[model samples]
Target: MSFGLVNVPVRLFSATENHDVQFRQVHEKDGGRIKYQRICSIDGEEVPYSDIAKGYEAADGQMVILSDEDLGSLPTRTTKEISIEKFVPSEQIDPLLFDKSYYLEPDKTGLKPYVLLRDALEKADRMALVTVSVRSRMTLAVLRVREGVIVLQTLLWADEVRKPEFESLSEETHATQKELAMASSLVDSLSGDYEPDEFEDDYAEAVAKLVETKIEGGDITETPEAKGEESEVVDLLAALQRSVDKAKAAKAGGASSSGASEAAQAAGGSDSGSDGGSDGGASDESDAGKARKTAARKAPAKKSATKKAATKTAAKTTAKTAAKKSTTKKAATKKAS
Candidate 1:
C-alpha cells in the first residue's frame, strides 16, 4: 500500500466465509450424478475448456475476443499495491457501498510504517479512502483498522445501488405522539446487545437433520406450513399497545408472554398486506423443550385474531367514506344538469 512517499508492503486475505449448504443434480431413478458439456453453438460440437476465450459483444452484433496476452498488457493487470488518496471520517462512507473485505498483513520491513498508519487512522477515527486493483479491475476501496489489524474493504460504484421508485413511499405520512410512544416502548422491550455468536443457521441444521434421518431409514414427517395469521389487516396503534403489553408480560414471566410476541408481529405490519412475523431464533434447544415452547406460544394466535377484526372495521369505514363522497358528487352534478 502506498500513501504519498511512504510505501507499506502487505498481503491481502479474504475476511469472510460462506456456510451455505450445497446440492448436486442427480437422476432420481438410478441415483446417478448429472453432468453437463460445453458445446459450441455455431458447429454444435463439444468444446474443451482449453479452447475457450473471453469475448465481449458490442451493440452492432460484433464479437471482440480477448486473449491472455491482451489482458496482461492492460495497465491494471499487474497492480500489486493499494494507493491511499485521503483520510475521511469512517461514518462518511455508507455501509451500502461496502463490498468484499480483506485482511492486510504487513511485511517484515513494512512493520513500522504499517503500525504508524494504523495508529494514525485509529487515533483520528477515520478510514483511508484508497484505490486498489484486484483481478485486473481497478476499484475504490478503504483501509481501516479492525482488532489492531489494518483491513481493506472494497466499495461499489455509486451507480451500483438502485434508487427506490415507489408511489407509496413518495406520499407523506404522520404518526400521532401516542403511536410513537407505543412504538418506542415496543422497540425498548426488544432491545438487546447484538452478539453474532448467539445466532445459528436453523435452516441449514434442519436440512442436515433431514438427510441424516433418510440415511437412518427413519420416517420423515413433513412440517406443516405456518398459518397466515400475519396476512390480516390490523390497527397499528392497538397492535403496538398489545406488543408492548406482550413484551412486558414476557419480561415479567407472565403466562401470556407468548401472546405478546404475536402482538408485536401484528404491530409491525398494516392493512396493505405486508408481512409481519419473522422467523424464530436458532434451533439449539432440545426437541421436548422446543415442543413445550411452541405449545406455550399458541396464546399469541388468539391475540392476533382481535387485530383481524379491528382491521376489517377500519377497511369498512374507508369503503363507506369513499362511497359517500362519490354519491354526493354524482347527485350535485345531476342537479346542476
Candidate 2:
C-alpha cells in the first residue's frame, strides 16, 4: 500500500478459484465415509491438533520446530504495506511467471490516491512492479488496473522456473522446407481469433449434465463400479486417412438415407395410383358384364313372337283354298240340270 510516498489503504481479495469437481474417499465394502487422521511416524501414535507444531527437517536430520509465537516475532520486509518499486511495460512480464492474483479495494480514506494511481496506470499502459510477503514468503508481483480497480498479480521466482531437460528435445531435429510449408499452411487454414467466452470447461459441464440427467431420471449409483477399455497402436498417416474416409462415408450415408426416404415416399404415391386404377378397371368390367346379361335375357322373348306370326299366316292360306273348291262344285251342278 506504500509506494513512492503514495499510500493506499486496501483490502485484498482473491482473484481466482478452482471450480473442479471433487470426490472423497469412501469404504468399498460397507459404503462408509473414510476419514484421515494425522499420525506421528516416529512415535507411531495419533497426535492432537494442539500437540502439533510446524517443523522443518534439515539435511542433517535435525527438526526445527517453529511455534506461532516465533513466526509472529520474526521480522518481515513490509510493515503491512504493498511496496511498489517501479513501473514497466506490461509485456516485459512473462505469463509463465504469474502465479496468483488478487484485487485490491481501497478503503474510505485511500480512495483518492487509488483513483489517481488507477488512472495513471491506465493512461500509461504499464504495470507497477512490487514485492509483497505472503504466507511467510516474499515474492515478486505486479500491480495493474482491472475493471477500474487495482489488481495485484504474484509472480514466481527465477529459480522456481524449471529448465527444460527433455532428452528427446535435446537432440537436434530437422525438417524439409516442403514439410515446414505444409505445416504452416495447415496452421494458416485453421487460424482464428481467440475468444475466451467460446471455450468452456467440458469435463465440468459433462459432470453437471450427468448429475442433472440422473436427478431428472431418478437414477442413482449405489456402489462403485469398475470399467474396462481397450487400446491399439496405429500408424499416424493411416489414422488420418481413416478419419477422412469415415467423415466422407458418414456424409454420404446421410445423403443416401435422405434419397432413400424420398424414393420410398414416391413409390408409395405410385402404388396408391396403381391401386386406384385397378379398382377403376374392376368397376368398368362389372358394368360391361351387366350389359351382356341384359342382352341374353331378351333373346328368348323375341324368338317366341316370330313363331306365333308364322302360325297365323299358314291358317289364312288354308281357308282361301276351301272357298275356291266349293265355288267350282256349284257351277258343275247347274250345267248338268
> TM-score for every candidate vs. truth?
0.58, 0.58
Tens digits of per-residue lDDT for model 1, 171-289 = 78889999999999999999999999899999999999999989688554443332243423345556888999988656444433433343333322221121112211111112223
- Itemize residue pairs with steric clashes in candidate 2: 1-82
For model 1, the superposed segments whose C-alpha errors exceed 4 Å read 40-45, 59-74, 216-337
lDDT (C-alpha, whole model) for all candidates: 0.70, 0.69
lDDT, candidate 2, at 130: 92
After TM-score superposition, the amount by which residue 304's alpha carbon in candidate 2 deviates from its true location, in angstroms, is 99
Residue-level lDDT of model 2, residues 54-114, one tens digit each, is 9989999999999999988887655566899999999999889999999999999999999
Lowest lDDT 10-mer window, candidate 2? 225-234
Error of 2 at 28 (Å): 3.4
Clashing residue pair totals per candidate (backbone < 3 A): 1, 1
lDDT of 2 at 69: 93
- The parts of candidate 2 lying over 4 Å away from their true place are 60-62, 67-73, 216-337
lDDT of 1 at 306: 48
